[model samples]
Target: MSTPEEVAPDADAVTRFDDLGISGPVLAAVRDLGYETPSPIQLATIPTLLGGRDVVGMAQTGTGKTAAFALPILERLDIAQKTPQALVLAPTRELALQVSEAFESYSARMKGVHLLPVYGGQGYGQQLSALRRGVHVVVGTPGRIMDHLAKGTLDLSELKYLVLDEADEMLKMGFAEDVEQILAQTPEDKQVALFSATMPAPIRRLAQQYLRDPEEIAIASKTTTNTNITQRYLVVSYAQKIDALTRILEVEIFDGMIVFVRTRNETETVAEKLRARGYSAAAISGDVTQVQRERTVSQLKAGKLDILVATDVAARGLDVERITHVVNFDIPTDTESYVHRIGRTGRAGRTGDAISFITPRERYLLKHIEKATRQTPTQMQLPSTEDVNVTRLARFDDAITAALEETARIEAFRDIVAHYVRNHNVPEGDVAAALAVVAQGETPLLLNPDDDPLAKAVEADGRPRRDAKERAERGPRTERRGRGDYAPYRIEVGRRHRVEPRQIVGALANEGGLGRDDFGAITIRPDFSIVELPVNLDAVVLDKLQGTRISGRLIEIKPDRGRAPRREDRGSSYDRPRRGDDRPGSDKPRKPRHKR
Candidate 1:
């Protein structure tokens, strides 16, 4: 085994993709995607892969590794030879689909180049037909690819290039055996490329067993978090997240922003809430089509959209120069994900801001993230009602100043004002004040701290407002748990399928557009799991969940008529309190009034 070579990211050395021997149609496609320079991984891996040598790339998810392999494959592709020549294996269906889309984007100018993405949940008929018709490249998950190979429907005998993307993730997901089996079926002399964020023992062994004297390229920085970003965290309850987020939006000055959530359904839920509050916002998730995702990104770049609520997979490889802020609406499960989420901003040496919401139970995750990144995020205090009022007043003053500059438009209004003053025998100042009131509309112009629900929810110390007696009685609310109003539902995935509670929640929330509060107890059993969902769910939402997949198994959800399983029989249960539940000190749920 040889040591991997460290590659310094010199954005100034090779300013453009054309400088790296990528020319003609491929370079044109790259320019069309608004990429002007190659990333560190691309700068090191492209020429090596193009030179026909096996390469092992060590880089993080947001480091442009997809293009590092995709561009070279496209450049060396034999379009006329439609048989599978390149096989790229990803760990999940979402990544496989995203890689497939990247291939399509890079090969836009090439004629007669066909690519197919084979993954679970999708119908096999389409994949089988595409494979039979012939394709230049195939990107798929390890399990589905192995299934195809066993069925004799996928032929890798003619394969020339193979890429194992996120290999460590595949291993962790229990696909090591399947991956090895698939690798064994490929040609002995074919070129191989393995990419992983971290090289564990299993990954190193797999690379050594397959790759032949591979050229090692490692792209890493001294600190994972960028110095150009000012990172901050707010301690807020799940129920208070929306209020804190909206308050931040009101006070923070940002050009463009992305709010990241853990589940796809949360993306739509958050984005819709932002829009209803008069922000130009949109949602992007795996459920969204590639075309719509592209359009939304374009709108963000073009200044038509101000905020985007996106899931991790959906925002992969998203590069926008205008993004000034990244908000982790829900804390990521892993430290690497946290790094990647904040990496969306503070790019190209521009200063950016990253804010995260952390609950008491998730404080340990934050500590892990800070330890991994080697930088502690500053604690942020939510903007006070007076702070927001001050900002509003400043903007109102600026609006009046700008209007004053438009002499031509103001002339007409000036004459009307004077005529009213003369006819009603009113002073000019009083007339002006009345006009200002009319212009401000029905919504109040300033926030009253005493009456504001958001102000009443939190105190100066950022803790939930509580009376002295109640505070002593309840102590500190550490963890919130309850079984809300929900009815039992059964889905055909369980311990047998190695499915987890989070996976089930993600799949259902994404497909059904349900918020986290809509979910209740999730009890995983041997063959099937019993989940509690909102009662009287729409028939359409149920149909959507029936086709959704978790661990490559269809949910096949239906009403669970059986009695609730015994507590001992339940493998796991997620009994978190609903978002709208009353807080410890509050008599009722707090709903903040929005003036925007």
Candidate 2:
């Protein structure tokens, strides 16, 4: 893949890293680092940093933001001076190491650039030695650097630049005082650069006090769900999503899938359950070692594993095209992560799908996601009895067809059928009926004979169809209620747009602030749909929804008056004459006038 700079030349249409108009040495270094274009933050901040200006950058993870300020520090490094010319402070030990590595990548073209990462977890012996050797750049966590400062092992007398990466996260983690003290230890005139995902009040105040009229650049979270993904969300309870996910897997023809959970422990638990159910699934999380994490990701990409239950941090830099689905086993904390989660699939322009499980309590979050992503998730109902039956029949048909195609003993079965028909002297029609009855009885299709089996199964499990074993556990629940009570309100889209019920829900939830549970029964037709929303909607909501469009057509929401109106009432009441007579009064007055 091309470097961020080379690929996105007009990151914000300012000077990209490659086009930064920096010294030849710096440009060469960037080229050697394999960067073709600067990231958005880099393109925005590089020019100012090179011009000796301080900056405040508001960006999120995975945006290559470290290189934005790191490159400029390298450009201005005074090799002859040899003193620490730049100091980068990170919130966490992990981030400090990452920043130090980035600095090294940018300075590879420079000789004797000497960069050191100082953090608390590692031995102090190495850090002290590096500081004593007088490195040009010092990248360390807030606490460790302060300790070194107190011990007089590190010096910032010659510091020219200072960077605080993920400043807000650090502040949240209770590193504010440490950060402030470290800043105090730096040179008074040092150019400070602060980068954070969110600009909370404290962070902004710190930037205002410390930074020198800094330029602020904020990249709002990207809301584009991969167009290649056919995204859906199933409304299942917290306790039931596991069962529901299994059921969905059984019905869906996914080649590979990634299941995202919020916590590391949950990753392991969910993966174990999936494995116990005989799926080719595994767990990956922050607690796992580098080797194991890499191995897990590799297995997934190689198609050795069908499912991966992972946390967000563990799944970083993962790209797999065959990932046909992404299951948000637990909802993401924020919108940005949701975009990244779905982005794992739908790569290389290949079409994929994503499904999320939303519980009743998470309906608000479901609406929030829809608003952020601009797509509503379909409010999935419990699968209906009829729907489940149909799906089961379809599965049964497929199984029978496969058996007939692959089995070599067709003659044996044929002979048995012939013997039975001849011995019983049965009519050919009667024989076929008997065979049909036997075949149907053996299959699960007729369990809920009058409903869609998949729908019934989903409703019974309170999730989507996952795998076979889960279905066994959900066997023979109370039959679902009839779908006949639904009243359809016409939504005006039709066959021209190729819109599905899920798309409609996603659009509404994403755009109209509707939740997954906000909708009732939905009836999709070739050209239009008569969907049911909750009864007795307030006028404000109705008015707000008036003149809206779904699937590129105007959705005129009105009361469903089932038939054509009578012609007489169509005219205004003012247009009809009154029943009282006027001719008699006029005639009596005329007669009196004639007599006079």
Candidate 3:
């Protein structure tokens, strides 16, 4: 019933969480999490919530909305009362779990406080046990909460506070009826907080129907994309993405990065590939346990991990200040997801970068994202071998400079070098070069320009050499055996693992950082597969591919010295007949001898 209040965009206005009237325990927890200043949404909503007035907050997903509502709730909680006094309803299981985790972190110093997250896919027995033991706060999805309410397992007679997070998403998900039912069961006197990115007609009507004359707070932004972040997208073929990513990683100076992918399997695949390429990377998905996910996030925050491969659900409500880059490995289908994925970086007015991989067919999605965000991403050029070499040389120089700071250690090494030069009657320059070679070890100091597919793929003007779709249609060219362009290499995954040629090619291309032209014919035998690769493949690259996995089995690739393995038992007699098999006089059986 009241006009919405516009919060000042300047976060510096509010220096501390304590200034918002947050209690000592809650402030302690905030400090523990390294949060110094309150966000605009928090500055506007926390005081109002602490004053016991209902609040309607309008903000985007990554604007610290969880903390905005959570801090106030923690400050006002009656820890001694074991019954659920506060309930938070979210649209998805991921959001519910995230909210519960936030509550847990904020109440770490507070004793006698219990929190439970209830959602589908989790055992009901766990919820029943937690309810019987009594909890101070309950965070859950509307459907599961409705089920519990219908079964008379949850009581809201004494509830004091209720919050609906991402209310617009809940409505979009068709949870309006369940949300209304849950709201009807709550106590009439309970304070409510509704937060949404956008308020639709139905949301407005629901607020009018349920909420008491609430104070409205809106955190306005001119655009969805952060101004501090440099947005860029590279037009690359699907097969060339990993190589492009590796080249970018070699060139960009980033403290931490999150590579967003579409599916749970991609998180593991990408993370595994990155780790194989000598990166400190880990994967987080719905399948990963909450504790492991938390640990992985914590490691990223602490700078122990440099890269995190994550799905959208696993990364919900993730706030880490050290995240300097966000890579959309697979572009999101929806614009909102794109916004959320890139929102992980450029937080708190810090500078960051967002790079996306856009295939030719997915170019339309980029246009949609640009239209929605009102910001066009600049076209990015894949780093050339020379560019990577420059970066490598600079890093090598910096390492030497850093080592020079340790005078005693450098002197020791210098004396050893001098002794070697004197004993071998070799020039000091040659000795230094030999020492540099020793220091470089297995990894090459400079990437071979000829082996750099990304450099050749991108033209001088920063456009792909050929259209991705056209190249895909043309397919990989067959290798001429004796011309020395391709050589046979054997991998350990084959028919036994139901491994397909496409899978082997994908694994090799991604892990080995090779292009489509770099691959030759692939033969899938019973126990192992023989694939042709560039004869000039770097030994280091081969070593890296030795750890490449297909169907969860390590490839362990080695040069194929002997002839190709026989494929005599390729087709089984028990296999079902194909459509054409029964239509003509084919050697294949019309029917299986027995049902497989």
Candidate 4:
């Protein structure tokens, strides 16, 4: 399909809120937020949206794109009507909540204005109560929105504006069908705005089918990886991440940092461990109040706190200039998230550092991010205890020198020390040494991180870390199984059929009714693929899968010769290696990145 013509936004546009015909409470809110000018996306989108036209905006995360559409929606909102005049569909619940908060913040002075953010996991009673109370704006994820519509709790009759934010991500998460279904239920004359960082074919088709005479605008963000940020990656097994993270933390020179974890529970778990290890750390998650979150962030900025362990939601829309580092304790699910995570640091012409912990299996995503960003992150080696010790020594020396620079305080202390030395007849150096011991406190002067159980596991039984992870026993694959092992089965679709692992997985999950827990290793070879199924497989499942057509051919399942297929040899996929290709994800249970 041909791409739509881009209406390029003027990078040097001299647009103001007043110039764009925005006034009243919305403008006052903007001024309160200290926004002096509109961004490129805002300049291009706000005017068209305010003029009551459909808009297709293209911009990356952190590009001030939220304000672009939010301001216009607020300006046109009928505060007195309040029956869901505007609907925003975000891919994740975190984004939905953030957008809802932004709407509330921007419409603070607009009397009678009400906004509601609906998503999964939140109690339905709370959302139902808000909707019954006659909210003016509704923001939600596709699943929860569909739920509300199905239950008739959410109404769209008065919806004048509908926004599909992060459309590409929603499509990626298998929400394209849900999105279309929801769009079908919206008012026919609704002003639709679809925004995405990258316009894949599916999103394009969705836009073509829905948006009418759209004002397409592209905000050309600099997608280049900031050279000022040093990016590094560590490939470790899932069980070893916490240990590896601690070692990295010990070695890196950072002022204030954000450690990104996948879940709220992980944030607390990691923060507690870091605190136990003598680091000033706090966990930020959805559980924390807004006041507590702000306090923690303020403390982080003031250097009273050093590390923040945050879930995706708590970290959303967070802008703290003092963030010197960002550690992805768990790898992000997608390339866009990776970009956004690293973007947390390295802002405003300041240098920053980003470190990502990669599991062996997740290497595919790493390669995807590298290709997207066009910069291969340097592979990081685990820091030794000596490295930590040296860094600690250097910092200690710097602190002592700074203390000595305080002339008045040091002179007073110096006289007290001299008097003590004179009275005790102890050598001056001995007296100073005793005080140094006090200053050192109870913290270990040096750590032998090599002796850590986590590190020991990596080197367990004299096996190399890579060997330990790669060869760990999960279960028997089709070719690897002996006569008694879980029976191996062959599906006549493989590399020759251009069948990827995900496609095979989908077929098994959809047709066989087997969950991920039921499956074992999948080996896709040139002509056929081998997968391990249950020993006494269900007759119904086998019957359903007997003739499942894949890649234009009916998939045929059969007993396999008990010899392992060339598993995704990863390095070359075969011993006859020739070219450049490496698969990184090792056999580990990756915690699924629950959206929001």
Candidate 5:
């Protein structure tokens, strides 16, 4: 195995499929699929890969990396044989299906070619049967592939080419060990190609170990800022973020929008909330069916849907040119993720917009994002009551103008208004006022100021104060707590695993059979966070709380130290928001954590 030096770009590499050296059948498939010139990565890697050489290509997502490897892999396939010869491993099930579809599209002219995508959360009987029946290509995740290999259901003994798609993502998802174990089963002489957006240390080591003197191709990242994309953020409370998002949706002129949330639960919740507010929004998460995910994305691309709320993992390889806005409903956890999220828009030289919602406490994360992007995100002020009213009236006016311009028959309505004046003997001004009221009623003009809670709250805080009246009777508290007695426990996880105080508090309150009030003073220092719980609580509760998750890590909740550190007593320490330091806001207050 040897490493090939960087090769100069083939003159025709950037050309359209017809002009490129791709065969007649491949050209026909490309034409039918309606794709034009090759993307940067595709231009650089396709030829090398087609020549039966191993490849290590580094390119960002949505840069047509799929075709970079797929086109070449399909070109080398023997149409007569239906045996599994090539295997592709993707990080997620969504991408596995996509890669399989790409194989089908690229090999449309090949007779007796079969490609199967096998992944978890899907039927195994069908996959086993497909493998037995004969498939030219197999795409799957690492874990499922390992399972198939162990079951003797997938045959890699005759495998000639292996592709690790999105290698970096697989590592991040804790699939590094599974990937290495699966790779050990492939034939020693097989051609290996690895592609990733970012080359972390582990991936670099893997490539060095696996690839035989492979050709290295690195497509330079698009470094120039997309001036066409107007990036901005709105500082709003967590409770008011949905309202803030609704206001922007209502007022902004967008062709299509993708709203990203952190969790799968939030994707559904946010989508449902938008639907209740009358927005044509859909949700896409890992739990959704393949058909549902396809339908949701297809609808958005076809102009039938206006907004899609999706998680980062679920929205991979999503390329829709009509998407005009990308909303970070929840700030992305890292800089690279933020880049990918915003890259969905401002395509084809069309101007786009990305707006993020940052809470006061999370403002520091926003600053980090700005630094990563090398551009400050403009702060978006809440829409004032006057602004909302003005926009509402303008919409009404636009409707009237549209009706007058487009309607062929307005004489009847005009005559009716004139007739009303004559019959009622009312002044012309009064009749016009009545007509305006009726016209406004028929329009889709939602002018309630409080509909935007953030705006309303800001406005309320600005005005004269009003005293609130206490309820006649106190409502029942959710949980009762003991004042003095407190129990303590410790978890195995520490700062290395990224555990935080709130995560521990939430985990304990929800899983430990401890009510909100049952938790006493909480202290989170370096390594671990200590929480005070009711002493002598049920042994069953203690047993359950032990082995509970603090921050995605099982903890051993036991006893705490006698002397607890007070919150105000401790000097201000480093606080990193969940969004990481790469979000918005200024980094004025950040300091590196001090080591003991």
Candidate 6:
């Protein structure tokens, strides 16, 4: 329940894992895992944790914080006396399983060491049997840990180390009490290491009450996204997403890739679409069996699979070295998920590319993500038709070269073709051309791309452009009479909620990041309200407005479906202004009575 003051390190002393005095077996396993340089968190926290001091590490998600405390625990554990020497608590079952898997990987050379993951929705018999057989480390969620403790099945009496991974997320999921109960069961002398992306007040209080003077190590998140990654996005309407994604897959050269979607349904749909286009693709989600998930991931790692379409939950903690790109088929709902989505690539110090498909209305989310990650994404325009043709032909050439390599005896066939040309008294070029036509199957070898619509209708920024024909067909029309550059949007708040125009405008300007000039009209009805906002609003601005409150009511803003008609569709002050009038007119200037 208490910790001692942290032992401070000497100034300006830099050390590697080897210099930090890690055991030979552990260091060997680390090197075998292909990690040469230590991350900043590892460099700062490893020495202290190795020195048997309680430590608190603050770092972003993909910063290799796992190895910082994991290695020290591995080095300190006695192989023979395996009665749960260490307990690493994670927030979710996925994270717990990943942590245990990592321990197994790092302890490859450490014989007789067993790490078990205990979490909810899993059988107790396996965990109980593993305990009976004596496990060295137990990684799990707090709820299951507390269950074992209450049942007197887990022997934390012999536990020497405790780790709280992602403490803030744990607290958010209402595990604070369980964590405290579990901590109280461990020996007071146990070395506790807490790592969180953020140190919220509750976690700070928990640390203050539980951890002895802990060494504070904070690694500020980078001001920008990983420089090793080339980030770009494609803007297309929601309906055109599949076509756009197919075109990009045709143009981009990659080894293996993961395409992230938002829903379980979408994972299958996207993967099927890619498969129909001849991609070796698969879909994964939480609904799949563990065996299926493992097989899918194994296929991805072994280069048997080219594209994996998955939802975030199914893809958590997946580390595959062959992953060359991560495509966000649908933008993540939040920035933290976005960071983790891209982190699947650009690992092991290898340069990677991350592409996303966004609609025009969703560009605001791009700006929101940019402010969150400190990286401005460039839009990838559609590939030119000629460019696509060239790429396809090059692939065809590669296919031909590979086929020729496999057909070592094609020389005889070539001689026969030469004999045929001579006998027919035809040009050799003409004979070769006939063979190519036969080999091309249904698709032509040299396609004329001049008729491609995207050649002229796609802008550099991925936005749609009108061609001359379309522009000529849709003749010009007069602009709206009132509200310059503002479009009518409806909100749920209304006269029933005592909504007011000034309150709506104030909320839009202050909470929605809109200017006063951007608002034009506001009308509150019995159950809904309509307001005007500048056209082409920023995504962040729209999101903020959607969550804004006036009179303690949520402003769920959506495009006005041509505002509901009233007896006065003939004359509403906010709808439109009359000619020769400086302002909109109403038949009844005095506010009408409400039904409620």
Which stretches of model 4 miss by more than 4 angstroms? 1-10, 223-226, 233-248, 255-277, 281-351, 356-596
Candidate 4 local distance difference test against the native: 0.72
Regions of candidate 2 where Cα sits further than 4 Å from its true position? 1-15, 23-29, 32-34, 60-63, 80-82, 198-200, 218-223, 227-321, 324-344, 348-596
lDDT of 5 by residue, 1-596 (tens): 24433333344444775444577677677765556777667776777777777888876555567777777777778766666789999866546866776677778777778899986445556887888889889999775676576557788888888999878767654466668877898898988899876777778888888888888787654433566888998876555778778777767878999999876778889999999887899999756888998998899989999998987667877889889999998875345567778888997798899998765434545544665566788887776655767877787778778879755467667788788888989987898777777766664455565555467553432332121121113322212224456666555656566655444544454344233335555545556656667675656567666645443445666776656456544432332222232122223343434434
> What does candidate 3's lDDT look like per residue over 288-328, in tens digits?
88899999999999999999999776787899999999999
lDDT of 1: 0.78
* TM-scores of all predicted structures: 0.54, 0.44, 0.49, 0.55, 0.49, 0.47
Q: State which candidate has the highest lDDT.
A: 1
Model 5: residue 69 alpha-carbon error in angstroms = 1.4
Q: For this target, which candidate reaches the highest TM-score against the unseen true structure?
A: 4
Runs off by more than 4 Å, candidate 1: 1-3, 10-23, 30-40, 60-64, 81-84, 91-101, 115-135, 138-158, 173-178, 181-189, 220-229, 232-248, 254-489, 492-545, 549-553, 563-596
Residues 176-249, model 4: lDDT tens digits: 65688899998899999998878777677778888887877776654457767889887765557788888888
- Candidate 3 yields a Cα-based lDDT of 0.76
Q: lDDT per residue, candidate 2, 392-424, as tens digits?
A: 679768877887885558667777878888899
Comparing 5 with 6 on lDDT, the higher-scoring candidate is 6
TM-score ranking from best to worst? 4, 1, 5, 3, 6, 2
User: 521 in model 4: Cα distance from truth in Å?
Assistant: 15
lDDT of each: 0.78, 0.66, 0.76, 0.72, 0.69, 0.73
Please say which candidate is ahead in TM-score: 1 or 2.
1
Tens-digit per-residue lDDT, 1-596, candidate 6: 23323222232565567987786889998886657667677887888998888888866665567888899999988889869999999866556766776787789888889989987545567888999999999999776676577567899998899999988767654466668878988899999999887777777888888899888888654434676788899876444667777778888889999999876778999999999878999999757898999999999999999999997667888999988899988875345567878888899789999998875434545754676587888878777667778998899889878878966577878889889988899998898778888987787655477676443433522544354355445542123224557778888878767655645654454344343345655666678787877676656567656655555555678889773576654222243211212111112343332321
